[model samples]
Target: MRRLLRLTFRYLFLALLAWVLLSLLLVVPLKWINPPITMVMIDRWINNSSEDFKLRQTWLSWDEIPTHATLAVVASEDQLFPFHRGFDMNAIQQALRERERRGQLRGASTISQQVARNLYLWTSRSWIRKAIEAWFTLLIELTWSKQRILEVYLNIAEWGPGVFGIEEASLHHFGRPAAQLTPMQAALLASTLPSPLRYDPANPANHLRNRANWNLEQQRRLGGAQWLAPLNER
Candidate 1:
């Protein structure tokens, strides 16, 4: 019986190894190439179960997306993105402290972490899911440049229920292309990213408006798009 149990464990380990290797093969190419679809898109489609339901996403290269959008997200979601590898230890500690004090968990996910989730994982919050996300985050940080990670994150992040990417989001919300978004317009979009369905960028609630203002201030404080200089591939 001990031998039988050992054999079962061996096969299970092999199966897990094979799964990770297969995923690496599939996911590594996305460093240079845009993914045709993400798991979230598929999940949303399945839940809707309607033929008329369409997922909106437009792939734009890193340069095509305006600097305002990048700065806004960095300021709003991950202020230490440029300095951190995949995880921000300081932010995590702060978030933990805040959770203890407030009795509510607030977001501390970095852009790299978000890219890992948006690219390779699902939305649910679980310890198992977080472990997988950390593995993929490490893989991505090693395999892809910071700019590539941000580009993929920007493009794959869900702007609304069916809407994905800034290009689609800009057109859907502001009636303009992403290239033309002003600082305020871009900040508003970034502010909605936390809960896109709950907060509409076109018609921002008071909370969202306040957050947008905060993002704009943070963007200015962080030296705006100039900080993105480090992200550019040499």
Candidate 2:
């Protein structure tokens, strides 16, 4: 019995060590190199399982991506992205309180957390998945800068059915490259992010148009492109 327990403990420790090393290998190089594919894209592909289903994404360097696109996502999704390390405690608390009040769950995932899950993990809502997501989120926050985090998020985010990344989304909706996306066009794209599979940016329904307008207002209030200057600092 004692020998069996010792062997079990040794195997568990080795497993943990391997997991850590593998995660480091996956994350550290991403600081400089772009990911060729992410977990979310794979999941979507497997689930669709149809010839019409396609995964579209284009790799744009940070310079090729425009400020409007970044600002739009920041305004629509996470305003405290530049300030938060990995998680947003305030937003989490608010989400908890709202769940208590409304008896409904809502997400408070920061851009870092989204990047972690989309890049590495499957789309599941188990506590184990959340815990793993938290681990990856911490690793990303520690390994990459704020600018890199947002850049990865923009590149990996699902904008529409089979469309991933700002470049494809821009061209699909507006017939323009991501670099030429105007503020309104960017906001329209960002507005679909919360429900990209459902909302169509090109032919926006009334609610989507309203949400895009609100994002534009929020972007203005957040000091526009200048607000992102801090992300470039380090």
Candidate 3:
């Protein structure tokens, strides 16, 4: 029993060391030479047999995507995405306060954190999972630029049943490519993000339409993609 325990401990330490070294290596310049990996790929491999959920995503370069799409997502999901480092403390606090008042759970995940969780973790929500999410969020923010983060987020964010990414969502919902999505279409897509399978952009119910319109109004107030134009230049 003692020998078996020692062997298990030794293997665990080695595995952890290997993972740390690989993570560090992934941050190096060589990472640029490799093809970008997104959450969709990881999900397909990890959750292939899961019967309860389905998701499909394709990575699109920043140049291939229009600014309107990102702006729409920002308007609907996280208005302060561009300004925040990784987490949004103010929004988190507000969510916590609201949950306390209502006696229910609420989500306060930022775009960056969502990207981190989607790419590396399971879907279940828990205190331990959230801690792991924070750790991965910090690693991604430190290793990747804002543009890369947004690009990855756009590619990984769920749009509908078996549909992921702006490109797929645009084509599936509106019969348009992501690059050509109008503000209304983009806003509609963004609004469905909260519960993609439940909300249909094709013929959104009253609540969905209202939410989409609200997001569109917010996008207009935020200067509508022009705000993100500079990031593309970088």
Candidate-wise lDDT, in order: 0.86, 0.90, 0.78
Per-candidate Cα RMSD to the true structure, in Å, reads: 2.3, 1.7, 4.5
Number of clashing residue pairs in every model? 0, 0, 0
Give the better candidate number (1 or 3) by TM-score: 1
Residue 213's lDDT within candidate 1 is 98
Model 3 weakest 10-residue run by lDDT: 26-35
lDDT-superior candidate, 1 or 3:
1
Per-residue lDDT of candidate 2, residues 1-234 (tens digit): 999999999999999999999999999899999999999899999999689888899988888889988999989888888888899999889988998999876788988999999999988666688789999999999999988998889998998778899999999889999988888889999998767889888899999999999999998899989999989875
TM-score of 3: 0.80
Question: What order do candidates take by lDDT, descending?
Answer: 2, 1, 3
TM-score per prediction, in order, is 0.90, 0.93, 0.80
Which candidate has the highest TM-score of all? 2
Query: Which pairs clash in model 3?
Result: none
Query: Could you tell me how far off, in angstroms, the CA of residue 182 lies in candidate 3 after the best superposition?
Result: 1.6
lDDT of 3 by residue, 1-234 (tens): 999999999999999999777766654342243235554456655766758755556668878878887888888888887788889999889988998899766789988898877767777778788887887788777777778878878887877766778998988889878988888888889998767878889898999899988998898888877887665543
